[model samples]
Target: MAVKIKLMRLGKIREPFYRIVVADARTRRNGKAIETIGKYNPMQEPSLVEVDSERAQYWLGVGAQPTEPVQRLLELTGDWQRFKGLPAPEDALKQAEPKPDKKALFEAALAAASSEPVVEATTPKKKGGKKADKAEKSDKAEKPEAAEKAEGGEA
Candidate 1:
């Protein structure tokens, strides 16, 4: 059987992840593999590609032909260059920055909302303003006296 180095599909639909494998060339794309050597995740911020250099070199030495995409991945990890006795490739990808946690973000917003000072509501002054207010206050103050006088006189 002709040995081949290739990628096997994994992960959820529309979100593909792959495993580098050594298998028979005649096997289906995702069929059984003789050995798994690495992983690839293209969905991440800085697409992730990983491979075992020693195993990859061994496979290459033993006449395992890598598929085109797998060759590119091996190149990204510098395994392909190393296998060919070439110098290390320059940085092809940057590391992704760590993202803040959702819970931490929510807590920060809650703390900000609570730290702000509370505002009290006040009634707006009417058209008559001070005169209307004074009249209303005087009316309130006289009602009890007027009711008391009426009650006393009736008794």
Candidate 2:
């Protein structure tokens, strides 16, 4: 009964999640497992891998062979290195920092906006766009016509 450690596919199509488990080598990819060790989610930004080191070491000691992909996952978790008596890779153990909450970010932006001085425009803006321009032109035209009528009366 050749024992093996491998991944069991889960989650929806095109969005894969996996369970790291120990099972018979001849069984199906997602068949019943003797023991579930951890989970893996590759869809995340940094990818998520969790494994029980104690269980992994014990299984490896008892002659459980890990599949290729499962071996990479175990390496990420440092289980494979520890099982093989090798030094764990430093970068593999580092986790990404948690993102700050949106509320705090919003409040910080509001604070920044409030601290800045507001400058008023020197010239007043016209309320009516083309209508105001047309009214000014009509007033000038009327003023010219009235002057011509006065000059003609004087003559």
Candidate 3:
């Protein structure tokens, strides 16, 4: 029987979490599994991946083929690298603790948004020679004269 390492879907609609498991290749997705080895939570910032390294390596050694997403998760959790006899990644898993407080981050973002005036970005005008400059000057000259006439009419 061909064994496959794959993700078993869980969680509510529109919010997905997954369990990494080893099962018969012909088994339906989200079906019964031989063993659950880990979990993946993509809803978290940067995503959360946890795996049982020993179990993962043992299954890989015994010829369980990993599905693409499972393989990617293993790569992330450093299990895939260890399975391939590679060195542990430097500071990757270690640095995974919440780097900053989430509430503080949210408040700072909100404050920044509220404190600033929204300005639309204008595309730069293409540079042309004298004709362009003359046209620009004519436009500039028209605006203030129009403003002056309005002011005079008000007076």
lDDT of 2 by residue, 18-123 (tens): 9999999999999989999989898887788888889999999999999999999888888888888899988675576899999999999999999989988989
lDDT of 3 by residue, 1-155 (tens): 99999999999999999999999999999999999999888888767788898999999999999999998888778888888889977647433564788899999999999999997669776688899999999999999999999999999
lDDT values, one for every candidate: 0.92, 0.92, 0.90
Lowest lDDT sum, 10 consecutive residues, model 2, at 88-97
Residue 92 in candidate 1 has what lDDT? 74
Candidate 2 is scored at a TM of 0.66
Better of 2 and 3 by lDDT: 2
Pairs with backbone N, CA or C atoms under 3 Å apart (clashes), candidate 2: none
TM-score pick, better of 1 and 3: 1
Writing each residue's lDDT as its tens digit, candidate 1 over 1-155 gives 79999999999999999999999999999999999999899998788888888999999999999999999988888888888889988977567888899999999999998999886658764569888899999999999999999999999
Which residue pairs collide, candidate 3? Answer: none
Q: What is the TM-score of each candidate against the true structure?
A: 0.64, 0.66, 0.59
Model 2 regions lying over 4 Å from their true place: 116-155
Rate residue 72 of model 2 by lDDT: 91
Model 2 root mean square deviation, Cα atoms: 8.1
